[model samples]
Target: MLQLEGLTRRFGANTAVDGVSLSVPAGQMVGVIGRSGAGKSTLLRMVNRLTEPSSGRVIHDGTEVTALRGQELRDWRTDCAMIFQQFNLVQRLDVLTNVLVGRLNHRRGFGATLGTLFKRFSAAERAMALSALARFDLAEQALQRADTLSGGQQQRVAIARALMQQPKLILADEPIASLDPRNAQVVMEALRDVNRRDGITVLCNLHHLETARHYCDRIVAMQKGRVMFDGTPAALTAARIRDIYGVSEDEFDTAPEMTAPALTPAREAALPA
Candidate 1:
């Protein structure tokens, strides 16, 4: 299980995440929804240890995540993969190479070091990466530059890269925000597949209510840095969205200017090591 106990993040005088607490069961697919600046992304980043909390504890199973450091920290990152809105990839690198980056932490001893230094991958690792790409229907584009793919394809590649990590959990922060509706559906389906087939725990930050309702096993609504609602998608009624977001149902459904909230400078530098 993943537990957040009184998790909070402060940016100077402003608190980005305010004493948030929640528990996520293993293999559950959760969608976090909130308006812009609602601290939704910050919460996910904190769970992945990409952003440290101000005052609280994050525990996975029995391990205290906030206490991890050094090689422990690196290993923790491998165990929890993070997917970003921008599809953070080495744009100049081949698609397969980017996916192989997930295996960096698993490499050991001199041969692994030398292979990485020389940009060489073992045949078995190459095959594994190819299989991950194939899962997302991107094997044909494996040799293409990551920058050459469309927005949706790039996001799918990012998902494949996360799968390559063989992680116990996935933290996706607004993964579909930049894609069109069709592409967003594809990405959501891909994530759903990862959750169901591999049983990896998935915590995704989403902008659209219907998208969340359609793909998530549970929906967690946040407002002003606190969890406003937590329940099955079927329980999230139109009136509840209005109450949580202080907007009418239609306004929440057709949000035109919503964007992934930015991180504070203190949190920005806390990216996964």
Candidate 2:
């Protein structure tokens, strides 16, 4: 389990993440939803240790994650992978090499470091990286440059790279915010598959209420750096969304039929069973 006890982060006079506390059980896909600047990204960053907390503690399975440093912190990062809004890839590198980067944590010794610097992978390691890409149907594009693929394809490559880390937890910060609707659905479904099939915990920051309701097992609503609501997707009703985001039902509702004014990609997989 992951526990956040009064986790907080401040930017001088402004607090980005307030005294927020949360406990996440294993193998759960939790979506953090809110308007822009609600501190959702800051909260996820703190959990990943990318953003140091101003105060409070983050404990994961009995370890004080906040106290880890050096190699310990690097190990923690390997165990907890992060996927970003922008698919952070080496544009010039082939998809396979990028995926193999996930294995950096497992390498040691100067020889291993030199091998990684030159992008040289042993046969077994190459197979492992290939397998990760296969999960997202990107194995066929293994030799392709990451920048050459479409936005959705690049994101899939990013996901494949994360899978190679063999992480226990995935922190996706607005993963699909930049994708087209069909691509968004594809990425979301891929994430859901990872959560269920591999039993990896996923904490995704989402912008669309319908997207959150469609893909997450639980919804965590944040407002001004604090958690405003936490419950099953079924419990996050339209009225509750209105109360949290200060928007009317229509603006927040992303139901398939309700949102599909035309056959746009955004509506293609608005809801998935």
In angstroms, give how far residue 28 of model 1 lies from its true place.
Answer: 0.4
- Residue-wise lDDT of candidate 1 within 1-273, one digit each (tens)? 999999998765667789999999999999999878888988998887777888899999999999999888888899999999999999999999999988899987788978876779889989999999998999999999999999999999999888888899999999998999899999999999999999999999988888899999999998778899999999999888877776876787566434345655666665432
Candidate 2 lDDT, tens digit per residue, 146-222? Answer: 88999999888888889888999999999998999999999999999999999999999998888998999999988
Indicate which candidate wins on lDDT.
1
Clashes of each: 0, 0
Cα TM-score of candidate 2: 0.91
When summed lDDT is taken over every stretch of 10 residues in candidate 2, the lowest stretch is 256-265
Query: Where does model 1 exceed 4 Å of error?
Result: 109-111, 254-261, 264-273
Question: In model 2, how large is the Cα lDDT of residue 75?
Answer: 92
User: Candidate 1's C-alpha lDDT?
Assistant: 0.89
Candidates' C-alpha lDDT: 0.89, 0.87
